[model samples]
Target chain A: MKNLTIPEEELMLPGHTACLGCGATLAMRYALKALGKNTIVTIPACCWAVIPGVYPARTLEVPLLYTAFEVTGAAISGIKNALEATGNDDINVLGFAGDGGTADIGIQSLSGAVERGENVFYIMYDNEAYMNTGVQRSSSTPKGAWTTTTQVGKVRDWKKEKKKNMVEIMVAHNIPYAATASIAFPEDLIKKLEKGKNIKGPKFYHIYATCPTGWRISPSKTVEIARLAVESKVFPLYEVDHGVYNITYMPKKNVSVKEYMLPQGRFRHLTEDEIKEIQSEVDKDWNLLLEKEKWTQSLNKVQ
Target chain B: MKKMLTGNYASAYGAKVSKVKVVSAYPITPQTTIVEKIAEFIANGEFDGKYIRVESEHSAMASCIAAENTGVRTFTATSSHGLALMHEMLHWASGARLPIVMSVVNRSLGPPWSIWSDQQDTISQRDTGWMQIYTENNQEVLDSIIMAYRIAENEIVMLPAMVIEDAFILSHTMEPVDIPDQADVDEFLPDYNPKFKLDVSEPMGFGSLIMPEGPFMEFKYKGHESMNNALKIIDETDILFKKKFGRSYGGTVETYKLDNAKYALVMMGSTASTGKEVVDKMRDEGYEVGLLRIRSFRPFPKDKLRNYLSNMKSIGVFDRSYTFGYGGAVFSEVRNTMYGKNIPIKGYIGGLGGRDVTMNLIEKIFLDVVNMSEKGQDKDYEWVGLNGDKRWSQ
Candidate 1:
């Protein structure tokens, strides 16, 4: 992409406790670069909550307020208002949470924060399952994935429900900004985070962070798996700003969903029929997303 | 200006005079009108603040903690289930030492839901490290909200406070409440300007894991000491409030004719208002009975209670909410405080689940305590107004 430009400043300390090739860790690293030192981050219960280590030994250079599992959005709104009240309006407030904390247990508070039009940035690092809880099934777990709760035994159930569409769910609130990003594409992720920070009202970002420990993939292959997810259109790279849909990156040719799933042990047991079904579902989503962007652009043109 | 207001409106006016910077709350029974009145105040330009309409009680408390940490005064209100839902975060707010003030309209917990008055909702939150203040009437509700901020925000006592009132009983019942001047409240509370906040210029992280053996134990040690410190601050604030507004709730525990009485009945919240009425009625009939109303419950008023009970030969505790398999909460605290004093005490658990606690019921409890031949030292509690209780049944 013509010499990708990332800022030189490193906001994450080198001795953090995150696993090797951990996508959420990298996501936090890149996020701090975009947000810089003038940021206050509130983390709900997630991998990052523990990754920062104990009180006096935090890795983040910025101020962080660790909150209860479901209060990230509410905490962000509070921090933002607090800043305004105390005459520190220039600093940014960001809420960082895991998939279980965001798409599942935290959805109501998140929805309330956005509906109230609070000025804050919410980043949901989607690891698909409740990884920190030892890989239990969360609403963000993709279909045909094997989590502890979604065991592939007896009835052969492996998360039959589809992964919750958190981006669309957030957009339904008509917030100023909602975007889908991935750790594989740091430039796009960073750009979107910067854009979100610039927006005055509530902004949400759903970043596809790969979990090697939870998904039973090689730790080194975490970013590769994240890349495959975007290439296969299973986790698209897109942004919706002020009701305007825009797909920022489009792959030249879609690799099948099998190419995305085969390396991960969580999806290893899927049969050819199941792979085809997943492929069809991915194709359906891609087509709908394109149609939405086109219709939104045309509507803008007419108006 | 004196206006007739429910306990809910009194709470709102109290927050208004204090100039709370942020208010976040969710609507539940008995608490809905509190937030409604606050919203009305904010809409009419009476209170200039950021009002967040949170989804649930959990979010409500979460937002208040956040706002409070930012070094601004914050307020919220909730009822039975809402307070229960906020239980986990309530620890965080107090643990982080945020001076957030909340009003709990005390409704009974459910099986078959009832919105009427009971003390369980706030009593359930007693152990959450928050300074708990139970108000007896609309005026106390209004005054306590302001004094709660003054007491809680005192540098030595930077813990959260809850000004609790009974659902429907005080929350819905109307009375004449004196609305104080904003300038006087400003002199009492000042602006909530803390020394630290969530600022990038001076970065600080809260809710960090501190090992108990290390500073974590010290953190709790300080928290407990701060709760103890709040007792003096509460008293001083009460004194100053009297000088400014010409009304003072006898701090910690307000007493009614307890100096000469041989028997006393102890209670808190709106039930104490009923006890006051009954104590007056009993005294009219040449009975030397008294009423000891507990105002600040978390610090437990150990010294004040001992002083009040020192002369009394017997005392009865009227608990509107039971402690389940144990005696009443106030009764348990009383026994714990008077462990060696050997004051004959009887605890009557009644008015649970919003059952009416009439004046006759309270009189019966006092009479029973005065007539008893046994010395205090009972593990069992007397359930008042039970189906076949002869003392209260007739």
Candidate 2:
């Protein structure tokens, strides 16, 4: 309820070509509120590429560069360099791309940018599937999701592999800032973005944006489902700073993972046993993350 | 003031005098010296810019693209494999129209992994929408870079430019280059003024999504028109550069001793130097053989090339890069230009992957062209410098 006080200033204008109740659109709205007007966004080929509308008329109030699907990292690095060169260090260079762009196609350039310690913020809006290219399964797509490429039937099945651990990947790079945010929690998402903006060197924000179009979910229940994801530990809110883990928000009451999945038709084929298996997976991941936070804290104490 | 300098130092000196704001690069052979000099310049405080030492060629290109989009005059250098690695961002930089200038030390792409001189790398990127210029010597390398900014940043042609030079042949071989004074360069190239920038004061959208058909076509059409217009700007800028610096070489194609020549040899890159030597030697011996050096690759200078070759008895094309299934890359383009015309054309696939195109090789190529013109029997394609054993084996 406290997060409802986010500034109502319309940084992203209406009449843009986003689908009805697009969670990614809301994510952009809130992100701009935190990053403010002094941000330059570099977007690779993704859904946001279409959402921003056509040239001479875009939804964003900030300067944006639409780069190749694989070069968002490089594009943002270039923008940051340009900013610094012109004595405009106050501006933030934000790389906004979808999970497919970040976790798959754009990974090499992203890794290179981060490894070089580029002074910029990279935000991967994870809606799971490659929504722009007609719901293909990206590496970030959760296991057991029925995508166009990962169809479920006899002899063939949904994605068998678990979603990639991008946060851990960012941690491996020892970036200055890396965090997981959810559109369901505006306060937490804005807080992470604002904090990321202040830190020097490469920072990453993996925001869980619900995709009603791709995920086969009700547009009206976008935020509600996104909230259930975090509450159920299906997508936990956490941050990693210089290899130290910090769980940003703890759910007041733990809910069954089924409560999060049952609402989405994308997961309708899962049996009760399969749902339980997914729950166990989420629990195991959350516990491992908790251990990492505790271990990092203890290391701080020893130091 | 003009000083004779090698092409490699000219590239370095061009970046130096341009007061480039950011330099991001990873070193590869041939291109390593360019960035090395840039790093030294930064260390010596000759240029005040952020020198980002990135891990790979990909990051180097990406960093500079970001830097340039944010309204900085960013500079980067690479060659061969390094250039290939930056392939994706090459499209991004030009499509975003960032006006980023890069110096490509030309080297052959690898399968056998040779780090010798050739034009394959830069030639392979001709479709990336960047204005590409080939430099003959140090002066052209220096002057083209300064002029590249003018051409790329033009309101009509706001695309990136790649100033390419032969790898070790030019990059490592230093000649006495007359370094332009900072003041003179300052007068020549003003501070880079971006038309639309990522600024806080006035927020705007750039490189945003263009829908399925309409927006994509519009952007592509504009890109095509801009590149077409760049032909005139390239020549105009060359004229301005000559007036200011008192020197000019092939604005599009450099013609040497074609006055009364019946047969002409056409080539690009460092091999053109050898071609010129052979042309002069043939001229001394009263042979009607001349040389034409193609300086600009993009905007292909089709008209200029056609006009130059129309009256020639026979035109010989020497290409350093291949088109794989097709014949030589430059040879195909020349044939396309000569299509519907009566000009006789002969193609020689030589100097590929850094093979030395010596004066003797030039003489042999010229002889073939002359033989083709006299006998009316044109050889489809011939590989130069291969020994009899190797030639038979292939």
- Interface RMSD for each candidate model? 1.1, 1.9
Q: Which pairs of residues have clashing backbones in candidate 1?
A: none
Q: How would you encode candidate 1's per-residue C-alpha lDDT over A1-303 as one tens digit per residue?
A: 587567779888888888777899988999999889989999988898889887688898888888999999899989888778667788888899999999889999999999999989999999999888799999999999999999999889888888999989988999999999889999998899888867899989999999999999999899899999999999989999888899999976658899999999999889999989988999999999999999998998998
Off by over 4 Å in 2: A1-5, B1-7, B211-218, B389-394
Best by DockQ: 1
TM-score for every candidate vs. truth?
0.96, 0.94
DockQ of candidate 1? 0.74
Error of 2 at A202 (Å): 2.6
lDDT string for model 1 (B162-210, tens) is 9998888899989998999878888877898788777687878787766
